[model samples]
Target: MISEKDFIAKSSTVTIDNGSFQWSAPSNIALVKYWGKRENTNSSNAISSEQIPANPSVSFTLNHCKTITKLAFAKKQDQSSFSFDLLFEGQPKEEFKPKIQKFLERIAVYCPYLKEYHFTIATENTFPHSSGIASSASGMAALAMNIMSLEKALYPEMTEDFFYQKASFLARLGSGSACRSVKGSVVVWGNNTSINGSSDLFGVEFPNTIHANFKNYQDTILLVDKGEKVVSSTVGHNLMHNHPFAEQRFEQAHQNLSKLKKVLENGDLQQFIQIVESEALTLHAMMMTSLPYFILMKPNTLEIINKIWKFRNETQTPVCFTLDAGANVHVLYPENVSETVLQFIQAELVGYCQNGNYICDQIGEGAINLSV
Candidate 1:
């Protein structure tokens, strides 16, 4: 396991220069969701700048639906301040600047070149933003990949494992789920007794124990609402501070992770469906039961879920659903059942999606280094 301390040692020696790098990184759907954070005790339970979760999480990296980011670094004419031009889909997204700037500031210490160079970042997503898929996870991970690629160019001696570990660590600092985007098929983030090499700072690949059947699983995202959520994930996570069921929910997640690991290794689809659906419902339940309650799931979200249950019961297609922080439904199933499951989605579940739009995606082979 590469700890945070071990990962930062190579950053200081890198020499900065004009460089351009691009990477396409997939977004992940957390099978075991990460909802709340463990706050800094010295800060009165206030949310720390660090995005460490209260419980561990595991996820599947999705294909077809991903973010492609290109970053160009140049020596800053004015060394006094860091500067950058950020764009989304060839348009300026002023709303996203602050977040990106803050992320850059957070990682400046680990990659000193960030402070010395001006950056121009252009990013685009295959799927619509705020439609339940994690854009931040893919976006930040892609950006982190570009950063690490630049460092790798500066220091050719860096190992492939070192590049990914540092990139995951940097991505975690940007978005909690982003850390898991670096690993393929399945990735586990946060410390848990069920998996070795898992860390609170980054994610570890869950390849060894995973059954062959799960390697090619499909995820068809039913976009119930294309619009942004009423409450952001950050705000939702913060509400856990006063949540009555927070502690119990954390304990439940730990137990579920252990059981789910067994199911994953044994290829138990029945148990997989149960645990995945339970985690999705539990995630929304936490939100609804918060002190200031909020509901991200729409009427159609439940409608689609109920219909999936009906189809699965009738056909025994071995399909299941999981959700992120939004209303969309991620219908997960083995690739062997993809044809049947996708037909079921189009025939029954498509009506629930806004404009009947859904993304056909599957477990991807991690990120692609377009720079090479």
Candidate 2:
């Protein structure tokens, strides 16, 4: 079991030189969405600083929709505090600095070397900005990987498993979903009785034999609304604190994950569709029943969903949809049915998309160190 103290950096006499590292990490879509955080308490009933989820959630790590980051660091004479410059898509992005600054502060205890160097971080996304994809997940995971590369340079004997685990651990502090972006065709976050080696501290790859039917699953993201959400995910999660149905909802997530495991193992597409769609609706249902009671799904979002339902019922093509905390819909289907589904999407669903825009992606193998 990994503990919080394991992440703390020990003093080292080894001197490190200035260097640059680049990495790319992909965004992910949660099959069982993580909606709320635990009440900052550990097993011993003591206050804790770690990000712990109320329920375990699993996701498909996406290919193509990702963030690529380049981190260039130089040793500083005055190693008193953390210093960094942020750039987005080749231009200086001041608005993004605060988030990165907070991330650095959160992980500083784990990576003390940050204080000794000045960093220039340039990042860009494959998807459109504010397009409903979780850029924070990919961005933070990529940044964590680059930082891990720096750490590896300091301790060359680090094992691959430890390196990825620690990277996922640090990424979770930046964005909760980012822990899953560090690895995967499928990843699970939060501890559950059914899944071994799972922890709220980081995401673990789904550690069971997956049926071949799920291989190369297609995720066609329909751009229903290409604007920012009125309620950020963080705000939504906070609202769960006093939510009347929070407990029930959290329990439902665990049940759905258990069901999903069998579905994945048996290639039960019908069960998969039912659980995935119900989970998506349940996520929004929690939002609607929250104290503030806000909805993220737009009119076109409903329209697209209805169309998908009609198309599926009429043709039985095994295509279904899942949602993040946004208006966009992710149309998921097995690879074998890709041609027919793409035809249906283009012919029937394209009209509902914002500017007729959609992206084609699939499950991917986590992040890559481009500098390597």
Candidate 3:
């Protein structure tokens, strides 16, 4: 079997050689938010991912921890049969076998040449696995980007966009927003057109340019209630559609999208905070609008929000909070103030709640390939 030593070259930009490939994916933060989908194929695929900053979506794909993959093929029987084996950090993880199997099956249709041999793929996440940060998007992007590099190496005639498009679609199958994560700082998807919810409206259309410019902003996530998985981003999205406030929330989200884009273009931190906070409030509001509805905030979650608000009131800081379907509140504070903000939150959380833990985070660098 081919090994890392003899397989491929590595770099931040995409690369490939022989039948092997390695690449990276950057985690995306939705500025305008991409919630409530027109399609409900899966949880990650339920919504589009948008940008929230005014820095042209500058994400880092650092040289730190990252997922790398290599592909190889072996002849099985007389028919050139195929099977995938995965090694995580050196040891094998069977959990990814199914994900790999299905990924290979889907890719086969696009790259018929893939059926010619068996592929051995390896992957790893830079962050802790199963974290609530929707790590799958970037992880899948890394996987798909690596595979696309393999395809490009195997077929040099292919265009980069062609490879990326294939990867984007495959990434979508794995995680919806991931498709957009394939490129652009501020990517937008789903109800991309101004259809006004009319029947005449065409299907989804993602723009080719950066829709916003998010600056260097770090997200500090509190693990207050990282327990049993809350409703899937998919199920929650569907509930938003069928719920009575579906249309109204959509309208509000559309408006928020416009406002966020404007804030990004203008680079107004106060306006940025205004739009981000409003969108966060709207996301939670839609959740409560669902039947058999519930809220994900814990006592600590409220305390965090309260303290942030109080601190902001006292210091006139631009810190803001956004929640998904969990009790973990993602505090979006500017990078320049990350240290102070993180220290303040951690100290307060430890002092007031005494139970919740705060993990210091940065405007995570985008995806990157690793060597050694």
Candidate 4:
């Protein structure tokens, strides 16, 4: 629930005398499938003849987030500043340090002006650490926005949108989805492009209130096992290139996006469930088709899916499940049914999902502007 204006206030207050700034940001989830790609990791269309299916899967993000990146400078003889640290869940992640270093280099490139200022970034998650949620996306987006806000305070020549674009672009360097959180509510990440120069790797605002206003959407994440990190999406995509179903799957995802769009437009619960189930299977299908046949789903994954199916059959309720390149399963339902939904999951689906935790959140607001 970190307001955009509040984030900006922090950055604007920093100065050579003060020499430090602190800021925080929130993360978001994709509603329609951002599955396949065209050029430069842009989200592609589903493969159906109509380009999308009867419904587009909807995703809602919550205000729950990570925060407070403090950037300060250790002026090297008043010229060069050196050293940095990146903390996830508060322990020094030396592994991500080099990546942080690269980030510093890139940021300096954007505003060669900020080259003089050294930085100390301290970020933590209010939400679960790495329970299949992309804390970094939310984290970096906040940092990027704050940095730009700082620059504006230090240099009024920069436009307000300057920092947002800079931060949005910079977030891409950290994680692709991070780009989406740059703007909140019904944002389409990666190329809301047209035949003209209308879109690129950025957020696109949705106009309809129906897709933007639905309040019952709930996603309950079940962490199956937070063990070995899954292959990075970059590596996974490379594998996808070699995958037999890669091309076809891309097509299917495009169609699914269309169907998902329809569902959002019409709020068709049944269609939403069907398309989500298929999209999840299709996403994993690409991995299964890889040369090594990496099956990303687990027994618990099936257990959840099965119960969902059984629940639907027994009670004729509309509930669905989806997977994203890991053992974790994201269960979808309306907000009002969360209690009953989670109850059934705990009783019937809990056995399959041992050694994991559950987190509940619904769709949330679009990116906000901090008035620092």
Q: Give the winner by lDDT.
A: 2
Model 2 scores what on Cα lDDT? 0.91
lDDT at position 252, candidate 1: 90
Task: Give the alpha carbon lDDT tens digit for every residue of 318-339 in model 2.
Answer: 9999999998999999999999
State the weakest 10-residue window (summed lDDT) of model 3.
50-59
Better model by lDDT, 1 or 4?
1
Give one digit per residue, the lDDT tens place, for model 4 in 186-259.
55543322212113344444544555325647777777866555666556655654566666665565566556
Per-candidate TM-scores read 0.94, 0.97, 0.75, 0.79
lDDT of each structure? Answer: 0.85, 0.91, 0.56, 0.59
lDDT (tens digit, per residue) of candidate 3 on 1-372:
111122122222433323555676766555555556553222231122211111111122222323455545454444354466788777788876786666555445445555555567666665655445556677677877776665666667767555555566656656555655565444544442342221111111223322233345577666676565567676676666468877776666667665655555566778777777777677777777787676766788788788888988998877887765567777787667877887777677554332555555544434454421
Candidate 2, run of 10 with poorest lDDT? 39-48
Model 4 lDDT-worst window of ten: 46-55
Tell how far residue 104 is off in model 1, in angstroms.
Answer: 0.9
lDDT of 1 by residue, 126-170 (tens): 877756666899999999999998888778898988889889988
Residue 343's lDDT in candidate 2: 96
Residue 359 in candidate 4, Cα distance off native in Å: 1.1
Residue 135 miss distance in model 3 (angstroms): 2.4
Clashes of 4: 38
RMSD of each: 2.5, 1.5, 8.5, 7.1
| Candidate 3, residue 351: how far the Cα is off, in Å | 5.5
Residue 85 lDDT (model 4):
55
